[model samples]
Target: MTNIQVLDNPTMHNLLINLSKEESFTFREIIEHTLESFSVNGERQYQPPPSIVNRPNGQNTLFRPFTSDTCIGTKITVESGPDGQGRKSPPHGVIVLTDSKGNPTGLLSSNEITGYRTSMNAFRFLGERMWIIL
Candidate 1:
């Protein structure tokens, strides 16, 4: 069994911020990975529709499973209705990653990364358009 590295919100936030720097090696690798995912060979990456479950307490849980050449994992997020005071809670989730051999490798807090990941697509799109305009 592989040792699982658990990264909470602060750690995950810091890691993502560092990795997102313009000069970071990991950021470049992430771009390469994103581009590869659109390639013919990488088209086989699997991501199925998420499973949603409504809890008795009015919270909905979503499990989104995906697999890549290197790892398989699921991101579980909970969506809660507004409280009695009419204030909605912030979205929160966790990502569980396992190696190709099925060993649990890491568990990451998805709160920050979820937004970061979403913004990356927009950034990538703008970057491509900028090159075209130039």
Candidate 2:
């Protein structure tokens, strides 16, 4: 049993904002971090394919595990289908962070991070091909 610091949406957002200010983080840092992971000379870690489970309540849960040299963790998200009125439920998730020794450290809400990562990837792709588009 490991003690995990669970961070909710507001807390996660505040932490990210604080961190960005303290470290002067920018979108370029996101792209660099992603590129570094896939570099030819960088150490590649094993990331098993995500597993999805469909519940009886019309909700699907996805569990994705990833590993790096310093840490490993899993992201679990639940997607609820449309309701009786055809209104879709917003997806929610948490990401568990663990140290190299497999000790759980923190559990963060994944909504913000997911959106940020997605947008960053899209920006990276477009930035790399801006000349062709222009």
Candidate 3:
């Protein structure tokens, strides 16, 4: 992942915006000067598979995984917007299960993953402070 990737999604951007609002720091600033540095954008390029596997004058088989369980994997979640918000619209965020190569083997909303990551970071920060006190 790269800075380019983090700033790409609106939800993640919104989350970062919220973080900036609460933490009083820009997302870019945090990414540039943070204890836990991570690439925002991670990409997996497509590779065409061998033709012989198809048989009978087999053409090139592109093993590109798109947005589906058959291509990617199962979508575990699908919700209509955030709670306390009106209007039934497309869900926000997506949970994607990736393979060992980081290719998206599955897709879901980012809600749970985002929450867990944020919470764990918070816990780690507080825990470290508590340890210092003790």
| Tens-digit lDDT track of model 1 for 26-63 | 66558568547744355544656679999776788899
Candidate with top lDDT is 1
TM-score quality measure for candidate 2: 0.73
Every model's Cα RMSD, please?
A: 3.0, 3.6, 16.5
Q: Which prediction has more favorable TM-score, 2 or 3?
A: 2
- Model 3: per-residue Cα lDDT at residue 76: 30
Candidate 3 residues lying further than 4 Å off, grouped into runs, are 1-91, 97-104
Ranking by TM-score: 1, 2, 3
Cα deviation of 131, candidate 1, in Å: 1.3
Residue 11 shift from truth in candidate 1, angstroms? 0.8
Q: How good is model 3 by TM-score?
A: 0.32
Error of 1 at 104 (Å): 1.0
Local distance difference test, each candidate: 0.79, 0.78, 0.41
Model 2: residues with Cα > 4 Å off, grouped in runs: 1-4, 15-45, 131-134
Full candidate order by lDDT, most accurate first = 1, 2, 3
- In model 1, what are the clashing residue pairs, if there are any? none
Encode model 3's per-residue lDDT on 11-130: one tens digit a residue. Answer: 554654465343633433453343222222222222222122232332222222223222333223333333355544443455445555556444434554455456556766686799
Answer with 1 or 2, whichever has the higher lDDT. Answer: 1
